[model samples]
Target: MQLASFSGFIKTLFYIIAFYYIFRFLAKLFLPLIVKKVVEKAGENMYQQQQRQQQSSWQKNQNDDTVIYNTDNVKKPRETKKVGDYVDYEEID
Candidate 1:
């Protein structure tokens, strides 16, 4: 009877080890797929947000004429032309 119990205990231990290995293999197989799905979902959400922002900006521009800066009325300040702002330096070895 003691021998039978020992054999049964060994069998149960083997089964537990097998189960652990099986679960580890399954985790390895599915982890990448889970990460890939999460990344894809995040990318899709980012793209959607960008598209919404662009659409909203476009709509706002269409509703308002002064949404963009007017280059015609805003003249650039005149500056005096200067020659040779940078000095050429020579490195001696």
Candidate 2:
């Protein structure tokens, strides 16, 4: 019974080591691909954000260009005579 338990422990340890190595090997193989995909996605997102900003700015500029402020059509207020007591004071510094 002791021998059987010892064998089982050894088998478990071997499997653990084997699984660990397998995980490490697979990670090494696929880590770069995953990183590359993440980087590409980030780049695409940044590019899309820049495009949106540029499009918004361009639209704002186009809207600004279309605005027409005609001062000729605006009526000026009639000038009125000043009616008040004028007081002259000297400022002393």
Candidate 3:
């Protein structure tokens, strides 16, 4: 029974060592591929952002050419009424 327990412990220890190396090996092998994919995704997002910026700038230029405005065409800010003219409060009992 003692020999059997010793053998069982040895087996468990061997399994632990094997699992540790297997996980480490898989991480070392696969992590670079995952990182490469993430970098590629980031590049794609950056390219899309640049394209959107170009599109917006082009649209702004087109709109600027179409609009004709002068001082008379622009509207002035409205005058705000005084608080005393708008609100009246009485004491409550």
- Over 4 Å off, model 2: 1-4, 66-93
| Greater-lDDT candidate between 1 and 3 | 1
Name the better of 2 and 3 by lDDT.
Answer: 2
Please provide, for model 2 over 27-83, each residue's C-alpha lDDT reduced to its tens digit, 9 standing for 90 to 100: 999999999999999999999999999999888878785765569978899898989
Better of 1 and 2 by TM-score: 2
Q: Tell me the tens digit of each residue's lDDT in model 3 across 1-93.
A: 345588898999999999999999999999999999999999999999999999998888787857555679678999987666556789999
Cα TM-score of candidate 2: 0.64
Badly placed stretches (over 4 Å) of model 3 are 1-6, 66-93
Error of 3 at 47 (Å): 0.9
lDDT of 2: 0.92
Positional deviation of 50 in candidate 2, in angstroms?
A: 0.5
Worst 10 residues of 1 by lDDT: 1-10
TM-scores, all candidates, are 0.56, 0.64, 0.55
